[model samples]
Target: MLHLILPSDLDALRELLDENPESLLDVAAVVNCLGTCGLCERRFVPVAPLVESLEPLYGDSKGLHALLRHNQYISLSEAICGFCHADPGLLNMFQKMKKL
Candidate 1:
């Protein structure tokens, strides 16, 4: 399935890479896993400090090489939605927050 929000244009992709080097690994990893994963809309969070600490790597290289160089689980899932057995109270709270 095509990513609804992610750009399909090469220049747009490059622009995104240039604008936010910190997102390099995350973008690369997601692109690499595209069309292969079952949960296409799944969201993930970095382990923190990992992406922030990748500036030196960004200066050296700018692809998956720089992205996945560190031996850290940066883009691992912090939370996920759209699943079975969700907590009703939590969902209610989210809905209420949306109304505020």
Candidate 2:
């Protein structure tokens, strides 16, 4: 569950590496904890999440208007830089989902 690599998930992180192998391990410690950070682990990007932005529908007395917000996407530049710069696989637990 930590390193949930698949055909598509590999595509999403294809560009982010420093041994993003390290980043792979970075995500491992988290998934290991159903008792620790379980049930809420989806926040850590389990699959190559193609999460769409919620276009807010402003309900008014006038009419039910749905406004599509502009420029909601975030750049992965910083995150990529961080993964590339930081320690690679400190836990080094790339093979398993849990530390233990």
Candidate 3:
């Protein structure tokens, strides 16, 4: 649970799956799960405490706000490493690639 890793032995995949945060099998069983639940909605979780603490060091609230504002999915990454919303970030990048 503390860490996840896949071993070299192909037969040992089951054990690795067991330790995996998101199981490859029976994925739908994960309820309110950040990884695969399509219906689950994301609430705005703040990534402020760390920056706020360091804010006094920088003494630049405006700059900090500007930096944090664009990365609205900060908490999403901090909370669940792989869980990301399908939003303008992905679509925008794809659109740019298409243009290129």
TM-score of each: 0.28, 0.20, 0.28
A best-first ranking of the candidates according to their TM-score comes to 3, 1, 2
- Candidate 2 per-residue lDDT, tens place, 1-100, comes to 4345422343344333212323433432444311112211222222111111111211121211111111112112212222222334522332133444
Total clashes for model 2: 1
For model 2 the TM-score comes to 0.20
**Which stretches of model 1 miss by more than 4 angstroms?**
22-62, 67-100
User: Which whole-number lDDT from 0 to 100 does residue 40 have in model 1?
Assistant: 32
Clashing pairs in 1: none
Error of 2 at 73 (Å): 34
Model 2, residue 64: distance off in Å is 48
lDDT of 1 by residue, 1-100 (tens): 2244345665665566566544544543544432121233333334333334433433333353344434232333233233311446655665665578
**Alpha-carbon lDDT of model 3:** 0.38
Worst 10 residues of 3 by lDDT: 25-34
Q: CA RMSD for every model? A: 12.3, 18.1, 15.0
What is candidate 2's CA lDDT for residue 90?
24
Q: List per-prediction Cα lDDT, in the order shown.
A: 0.41, 0.25, 0.38
Worst-scoring 10-residue span by lDDT in model 2: 63-72
Worst 10 residues of 1 by lDDT: 76-85
